[model samples]
Target: MSEVVETTDCTNGTTTTYDVVVEDARIVTPNEVVRGSVAVDDGRIVAVETGEFDADGDTHIDADGRVLMPGLIDLHGDDIEQHLYPRSNAAVDPPMALASADRANISSGITTKFHAIAFEDNPEKDRSPELAMDLVESIRSNDSLLADHRIHARCEITDAPCIDAVEEVLVNDAASLVSVMSHVPGKGQFRNIEKFREYYENDANLSVEEADELIEERISLTEAELSTRIDRIVTAARDSGVVVASHDDETPVEVERLDDRGIDISEYPITLDAAQRARDLGMFTAMGAPNLVRGGSQWGNLATEEAIEEDVADALLADYHPPSLLAAPFVDTGETLSTRVARVTKNPADAVGLTDRGRVKEGARADLILVDPEPTPVVEHALVDGEPVYKAEAPR
Candidate 1:
């Protein structure tokens, strides 16, 4: 499947070349999966041809007849926060948490991840604007990160003080995506008031009465300043060439409103009607992969499988779990493998304006993952920009 080809190094007057050629694998492209070999030179895919490559250099990954697909692009994931706070009161160092998340992501086949950091004022814990800014800076400055780290700032519409913080990231070009969200009990992710109360009590340590009062307060505050703040945040993000999303859209009217405001994506629409409306309005509808894997929503919203069946869901996010992205694609979605894979790969990449590295093609950045798609889907190796960042020691 692989052969050695020598070339002269003129400067040293000797034969030397170390290009990598991955051969004898089924490479999944944007169009179709073909049995081929891919040649990489300087972190770019130079060739994708049938059968084996007659030339090779330093490394030749045989792939052992596994599936070689483009590395996943997670649009919205909060797994970093989970690593940052493994327990309710336990907190780890930001860099250490981020490093741990990076290993998990790459091993799960995610080569590019947008770490969803919320810039909000919450009574529960320390998701302060200052912390968000610091985390963003940490992610941006950490060159040792294996995955391509980026920020997705979830701006709480009712948190008026967070506007300046969100704006700072956009103006400074630190955020790749921004989503406007409202967590009032009667709307968004808390459509079921009981679920909202449960989360408030458990996560925020609020009593029943206190949770009710905070919900009412949030509703009033959101109603008073939603329009103006939404406009300001959306305008700033768009001006910075960052993609904007509407989070937890609950109805068709809400989708229409966000569509009018030039939202590029609708994240986790709570109902089938909302998801359909989002697609009809030409906005990409993203549902959590965990919903599909768990067979339903944890907070009692529309099931992702139902949304996929209705052909309304266009993209999938890791949401709170990074491994869900790898597992969700293998579920029986009544679609081709390429189509299901695109929900995590090309769809999210295109929605977030990443024009390269989502598909296996000539001239694209060689961000790829090799998987064993059998009894259980497993990520065998993860490569970012033609370099192997994670490789499984055994079948997993």
Candidate 2:
């Protein structure tokens, strides 16, 4: 339990007060870890001291050397879809699923989440055009939540018909980020056509013939039509100040074309050459935190560790797993803890044009988490905008 407290400085005949103070923490900075305490007031960090705060804070905690780091900013996570459709064919109310998604993310120390919703032409519950529209509207309207929620509308260029819905979301301010994706039989993440068939059949619950026919539909999409659709998306996004990203850049040429189209973020570059090209072209390259945590890519593409080692990976997202985002900073990538933390924090914030709330410095937003790294870096406490949002309860 925490209570408000005040202390008097008799020498100066004055009192110093802070809204919150966390002491004895191994604070993570951008370059180095410092053993110190942090003071917060009015939703911002006001001071960081080498030792304990000389003045008392109203709400105080003894961190006991736990790791205090900035709250994670996840640019791509579809974990909410997991809650929205908990079962294979069952559906839950959007509000209930949203509440579940909020708790899961806050507990995992993700403060800024760009919830990914696919506006593709699909039949699945979560990715269907109907569901995506509903979700974007639902998430944009819902107000009560612990973590920050924004929409990342994923548009499949192969399905040119959905451009209307994509543009609608952009025009209506439902989605702030748009990703251009193409999952044709022999391109992007589905380049391994056989694996694509298997995965597609499983996800859509289709037989071999049905899946192949669907792939044929994607393959039949004319390049000119797809190019026109991409232009429409890029132009709308640019006019609306929405960030646009390229998905699964598999080659240097692919990276170049997207860069020329003004796509600034490369999400999940499948090869080292592509990731390197994105970096050279000044685009932020994002890989999945799950890939880094699990030591390899699920699709056997460019390994997350390999990208990190090559200094081409600038940010990490949760991809399909929220918990992996919290664990990614602890992975050993031959970088200092501070730099590793940057993969999820400062770098991500910068990638999205957010100039604040990603580092432990004075004048930064007090979006922070205390992690007990004994077992696997569990979040013990989380503060968003200087307010306690989550605290782990332990058995007495």
Which candidate gets the maximum TM-score versus the true structure?
2
Best candidate according to lDDT: 2
* Candidate-wise lDDT, in order: 0.86, 0.87
User: C-alpha displacement of 208 in model 1, angstroms?
Assistant: 3.3
Question: How does each model score on TM-score?
Answer: 0.93, 0.96
Candidate 1: residue pairs that collide: none
Which runs in model 1 stand beyond 4 Å of their true positions?
Answer: 1-18, 222-224
**Per-residue lDDT for 1-396 in model 1, tens only?**
134456675656775444677788888888888898887777878888887556566567788778989899998998888888888668898999999999999988999999999998773655788878878988988999899999999998878889889998999999999999888776778877787888889887888898888877886774537878989999999899999999999999989988988898999999999999998889999999999999999877889999999999998999988888998888998888889888999989888878787888888888888888777778887779877678784733
* Per-prediction backbone clash count: 0, 0
Quote the lDDT for 371 in model 2: 90
